[model samples]
Target: MDQAITMNKTSFGTATTGKLGMWLFIVMDGLTFGAILIGGLGLRIGAESWPAAGSVLNVPLTAFNTFLLICSSFTMVMALNSIVRGDQKGLVKYLILTIAGGVLFLCVQVWEYSHFIIGSEHLESILKGAGFTGSQFLPTTGIYGSTFYATTMFHGLHVLSGVIYLSIILSMAFKEKFGPDNYDRVEIAGLFWHFIDLVWILVFTVIYLI
Candidate 1:
């Protein structure tokens, strides 16, 4: 029984202290997101008339943004794979691509947020030209806007955090610090990045799609 327990623990990928700690953080962070999502759903269900997200949200733009983020997840995977294969150059290349994807995703999200918050004429015209219809969606607008911003901004912050984390890992990669013999740090970072991507999928579905 003891051996079985040990096997199970090792199977979860906590091969290093860093990996174990990251896994713990991921669990706690996941619960926080779960609570937020559940609370938001409750609020929406209780509200008499929830605003239609599609009307206010620039769906096409956000869909593109989502695609961008998903692509980052792929780049992250390739980065890990490259390091595991003892290809430091490939690792660095993929890391740069992943970081670029994250940066671009954040930029697009900021633009979306600004439009909803300021609703300037120039911005309005730009959005309208892009086929956006709804007006300003400030958090003060109603429950819909409040929940929308709260969830997305929270997730955005996570993406920003992930980007910073990946940047640190990238710096280390540039130093050639990780290799097949000692690449747990890179794997740990990949775990976090992938979690961010997965959570965003859930957020997009709950907040934007339904």
Candidate 2:
């Protein structure tokens, strides 16, 4: 009986060290994002003219995107919980749902950028090249578009990367590679997922509605 207890799994699938490594990567990423946010705030502060965040960006759409991310976070937790409880089916279900949510949010972002941001930037470049100088590219021309594109797009790329990470994790999950005995892997993924969600909430408040 003593040997049985000793034989219990010591290396949770990928080891605790690997889990901690993933967490460290997340913390470092948070720091990098914090730097970008601070830089933007500083730029705004020093400017004689600052653009408003609510003018050009679509507030309603951003609000929807914010909700989508929040829901995905919940789904991530559900996936982790299911795995720990040995319910592989539930785990796969929630993981797929979370991935779908991320994809939907990304699609919305692409459409928004296409309609308001990417198009504008291309237009600006063309005008500048033609010597038809204009301030349309300037943040103050419309506060919403400028900061919206800057902050959200910055964070959006992070979300895109995160989704890719989650997709890989989910693939392993679907193969029945992780379960109640090996829950650490899902926990690590959960950490990154929640961090992405938190960052988006902050971005929405500071860059879209504020």
lDDT of 1 by residue, 40-66 (tens): 999989988765666567788989999
Task: Identify the runs in model 2 with alpha carbons over 4 angstroms from their true place.
Answer: 1-15, 118-150
In angstroms, the error of model 2 at 137 is 5.7
lDDT of 2 by residue, 1-210 (tens): 344333334443544787789878878988887886777677667756544554445689879988998999999999998886778999999999998888889999888766643346656654455343452543343333355467776778878887898898889988999866666778888888899899888777766665
User: Lowest lDDT 10-mer window, candidate 2?
Assistant: 135-144
Relative to the true structure, candidate 2 reaches a TM of 0.79
Q: What is the C-alpha lDDT of each candidate?
A: 0.85, 0.74
lDDT score, residue 73, model 2? 96
- The pairs that clash in candidate 2 are 56-144, 57-144
Native-referenced Cα lDDT, model 2: 0.74
Report the backbone clash tally of model 1. 0
